[model samples]
Target: MTAQVQSAYAALRPADVVLSPDDLGGARATRHSFSRSLVRRAVAGGWDITLGRADLDEHGCGVVVFDVSAEGHRWSFVAFSQTIDESDREDRVVASSWDVTAALVDGAVDDDDVARLRPEVIRQEQGRADERTLIWTRANRSGRFFEYVVDRLADGAQPEPGVFGLSPYLLRSTAFYSNGKFGLADFERFEHGHPFAVPYRAHMLSAWLLRELGYELAERCAAARSETAVRLDGDWRRYFGLGNATGLGMVPYVVNHPEVLDAWIRLRELPLADVVARTVDRTGPDVPRVRTLLERAARYLAEQGDTEPTPYTSGAKLAAGLRPIQDLLTEYATYGTMGGAIEAQPWQHLHEAAAAAGSEVRGVVASVLTELADDLDDVVEASLTCQERRDIDPKMRCGELRGLIDADYDWLREFDFTDPTQTERFWYSSANNEEPRRAYAGVDPGERVQHAVDVARAVHALSLDLAGAEAATSVGEFLLGHPWHRGAVARVQSVRDLEYAELHANLLAGDFLPLHVQRLQLAVYGMDNYNPQSTDWLRVTLFSGAPRVADLVDGTADDDWSFTPQPSEADERTYA
Candidate 1:
């Protein structure tokens, strides 16, 4: 961390900060005041289970079963490891082969079950899983790093630490499947009484187990080749993480689950309000702590390389903007206070300063809040819930429904639907495996099967239908005549109170960048390394700086990995 950068953060404190409404916008306006009660919740409960591990061979071409039993419920995470030809190492959603395939079965498994699943699990999308399975996923190794580490360890030496920084994780999951697709257990089955009841807990746990499998594979392969093979260095192990490839297919989720999406954004913003309210003095003792946190964040941001080939975000812009904020923070640290006293709301004051600096700097300031507080865990738990039932108030008049749209979707009304540019793109599924894909409106072959992700056009068409209906007519009465409008009307009624429900921009517009949508959702997941491979798909690194599985399982873990990039090679060797 730079000296000035450290000092500038140390200068921040919440005093009698006050600001006009216009002082806050973008990153600054997003800040909120928080208290212990606001961010706190009942500590999440613990899970205890009998442990089991499989003995995979040196080649890693064998089965590993992990049996877990907690609170009278038991299940197995079954992994099938195999070698893939270099030509088979592709990351697209449609890829049919993988280095490893895994499944979380609903109960304890025996040899008979493994025999039945061996052939099918490897097939991935074409495989058939019974209700016994919870999730089916696959990962491909980071080819260069996997081979490099294995050979070095087999040669009785540690691989160069620098290799871990270039690409951290051994394998990256391309897809995670659940919810009864291809005959697996449906989500509703695991909603109540199941051990993995907290939404997608099954998937999350399965992915973590697969991460463990990756570690085991590398170790086993090394031991197979050399009697003096050594385990990966503990520091290097901490840097290991899972990578994911996401694309346009994930964009529809926010539109389809407006209530859930709104809840997530709403919870995130409230914490900012809470922090702003609680900050006391501009030069308070807490200034040192804030400064240290900001320093870590600034260093992490400084370390990001131009990894994405076609990034939606510009590295030059972020780098250029960060320097001035660092300089300002340095000056503020030395001065002790920006003004004579801490304002009535210092967080808001800080926010305004960041906003004035630039949008990118504002985001940097906003991220610093995570280090300052611990209450976000409760917010994260609340985000997992959704109002599953969406019943329309059929009695509401057509006029009232239109009023809801007019009030909530005013930005949406700006789009000119008749313009070809506004409706130039279409979203569809592939003919082979039904994976979501994007295509031009007139040029694509699958426009006839385009998914209903065009929320803007749907709303426009509904408005036209309502225009011809009687104002006094009930929505149910109108829907009875024009059944096609029911899905759009149901979505609008379900999300009328959700401020961040639908995206304000047109998804089908000529200039629409689906990468923006993917980044928005992934941000909620706390992902980093937003490396875009192209305009269509991108890769991300998760749990990169997080504690290793051994640390976590042994109760010696330090849970402070948020936004911290793995230290550069020099720092790695210094720590070693």
Candidate 2:
């Protein structure tokens, strides 16, 4: 890391600000978000996506393909579409079928490839593919919005922007399988110099292509119905995104990938701190840009409407909280506009002011600050794509390991394992599909086979074992006598220096909220309009305000797509 980047790390917000579940859960998408970064890279690299073929019938059952070219490489998105009854459409992993199944394959797709992939892709989990396939995914049409848009367009009228009052997606992708799952290529196969070299970029790109396919399917269905059928307006087209329903499977992922989680948190927090420390020039674009972002965020929040009631924070409440922050920013902007000297570290002051409101508002402020730290993009990207490896230092003295735990794993001491509530939940894989599941310890079976997500308990146990060992004994020597501590010891030694590597909360605690962890992961993926459907699962939209295919092709893409305000009837005339 450069000296400038090191300074940013030094200024990172306190752990309470950066790692608390409440604050992390409230995170909004910033420019560094995976989806946003992918789009920016796509535009910068002059990536092109074009329709390859569409062979659908009136019922919308057929094959559709899109060819994506980036840099010197080519890939194809092969989609198999079929109409399914509403009852058959399920988001649970246990479901055996979906409305559409697709694969993002390496190189150009030919007739034989499509024919071969058709049956396999439809089989989903039971399917098999070659190493050429990068991503395997499936989606179901959004019952509430899909046909509504199709019918409206067939009737020669644009759907009202309010049609997106609940969601802007026509299809909800429930799963994206990659990284060598079910015969697909492992990440290492293409991680070096591919367009999707960054982890999960292929998945995000697949989701974006699916969004485009959804638009195409809707248009095709509409055109079949009437001669007057029209395509979606440009503004509405860009507004449409891909919906996703994530469940308990993601919770274990967050726990298992501590290094990745740490990298994401630090990348976001450090840039925010750097921006906050900068002297704000009221006469410059920074103040106005921040003000604009605040206004856009408030408008976006106000426009959000949940399909069902959720216990999590509602958009309306967030919007209400934002009013005060917006008012404060407006005052600051006005003071600068009136030739008054702006306060030093005005951005920091703004952040401090937002902190007083709550974590949600504080996160919003931090996201806006990150947006202004444009110079840190390369640093952020490098950190995200860097190889993350956790290796045990077997030669380290047991006394040193114990001290490391005491200093870095201090949060582990908060939990009392003697209490049943602290050890109530256990994570295990379901037999049906090996899907990750959480269940109560005594009431549920499979505790014996529980996954090792209880880091706090493991470290606590390791600390006790270390106390009994000789202080001068090396970790390898101690582990030989207590093999179970190897995992704990390695994790401790690996992440001791990574400040944000461990979540401070106990995953097995009775009061632990899995949705908070899920929210944090989704926020990093650049999802928006969080709607927690249950304690273990929630719905979110990707690329809601993202540029459409035409925008990218025409070089009209806008970087300022985050927190998109809802379009209105007036947009019809404005875009026209």
Candidate 3:
């Protein structure tokens, strides 16, 4: 477990792994470490239920506070849940209020602190949080599901299991505010020795705790309505998770943070490549464990519901790719035996077979790599700290810059930026709230403040600017002449050395699938059960298959939930 041993093991692994690091799923797993870090904190008793009761009535309106103190860190999560009129309930960022408004404060909170934070958190983007708050967020219930569950519980019976299974979560957080937005704590505050310093620890922790609080609220309402009402089936409760609605807002994060993005993907890829180098012990007792992991993954993919497509990919396509790969893996575990051909470079061979099968299959293979090599999580987490800074080297010659572009961004050649459809869409921030918004280019009024997420266009324009410059002209001189190309040039130079650093898409393309970008990031945040609302946004569940807070408290929590499908009622009972 030492750093040196881990490094040696990684180096001994084959360069090629279960899937390419660039493979969408493998790349996504890197971001998924949010769960790992959260679980680590949970296991270590880093969080506390300072206050469990919600002071809400039958209409489900009230306040609840959760405080956590560990590793010399202290913060309180305060949520104000209220009843909203149907007319005021909207999912878009433009909406100002929600059924629940929450904030993570920098210190333990009391009745007076909750009173002070209530109005601001409720106002959402319109309100302000001082540095004392780390994150501000809001969620609305799945109105119909909420009513049904509440009504069923009020009647002292469990809602049909199918109702919970179809849409397993009660509330969907529409927005998360952090990183100094609204004068809250900037992420840098968590740097180095900070307790929740792992990337996205604050936001992920807030969201996870919010889900647990939602469950508490629901159960409290049930108990209030009917004295005999029992808690939601423990299995059903664990099956439920927090939901998030993501939009074009997330696309810029991937583009803006090349180094951070690269860190996530690279850390994940290292484990995969390391796992690929391992010899498959087909004859050893470890075979059953490996087979069980593969089977669970296969079952999850088989049941993954369909979603409408973006230009890039769809759930149906993912399912199509997964079934055959699952069968292949199942066959390997079933019929293939000791001294099988798979042992000859087990991971490499499986990866090749998956690639030969198809892109979706390759993605699943990458997703399963971390599970196959459980030790990789520790390695990946250790690597999360100590990110290398990526400063633009402006002193490079023009020819050298072009060569770098050619080596890394030749993918731009496939794009026709001049086409109307290619430049049809634009990403912009709303002046009303400064939240990210997408619009039709030229047709939309906010194009003036459009975000610079159009990397393909930026690169294309940079190439044109560079074409007229002398070959020996330094990049610094080129930037001095055309200042607009600086950001674009910096991206080209930085991403040239980072694998899976830049998203491969034309942001302005009429058919651009921002959902893929959203999925790519959210998947890293450990979201599954994707349910798209539109081309611009989708709702996904987090911690659906994860353990409850109580489970971890008593040391019964199992870390087997990542990418694993929720079991059916029959399966749960049978296994239990």
Question: Each model's C-alpha lDDT?
Answer: 0.65, 0.83, 0.69
Deviation of model 1 at 157, angstroms: 4.3
lDDT by residue (tens digit), candidate 2, 84-186: 8999888888888889999999999889999988888999889898989989999999989999988988887777866565457898998999988999988
Lowest summed-lDDT stretch of 10 residues in model 2? 336-345
lDDT of 2 at 217: 92
For all predicted structures, in order, the TM-scores are 0.83, 0.95, 0.87
Error of 3 at 500 (Å): 2.9
| Tens-digit lDDT string for candidate 3 (1-576) | 677446644564232221122345223333235865676666665454455446877767888887676566787889999877877777777786789999988878788888899989999878988878989989888766777767666666665644543247878778778888888887776656566677777888788888887787788887788777666674566777887767767778867877776666556567666766667655555456545655665666555445343333454456566665555545566656323443445556666677776655665675675566655555676666645454678889999988877877777886887789999988888877557877897777988778878888988899988988998999998888999988887777766756566666777888776666676677678777666667777777787767777765567667677555554555323111
Per-residue alpha-carbon lDDT of candidate 1 for residues 1-576, written as tens digits (9 for 90 to 100) = 445333433443221111111111122111111111111110122333333666677688888887765556677989888888989887676788898998999788888999898887888888898878889999988876788878877776665643554236788888788888878888776545454665656766676667667777888898899888877664556666677778777887876787766665554554554564554554676556556656666666555554433643344445456565555444555664446553455556666676686644666676565445454444445455677557889999999998887886666657899999999998887877456777899987988888888988888889888889888999999999999988889878988876567766677888877775676555555455566667766777655655544553466555455555554454323111
Whose lDDT is higher: candidate 2's or candidate 3's?
Answer: 2
Q: In candidate 2, which residue ranges exceed 4 Å CA deviation?
A: 191-193, 305-309, 336-342, 386-390, 571-576
Report the error of model 2 at residue 276, Å.
Answer: 0.9
- The most accurate candidate by TM-score is 2
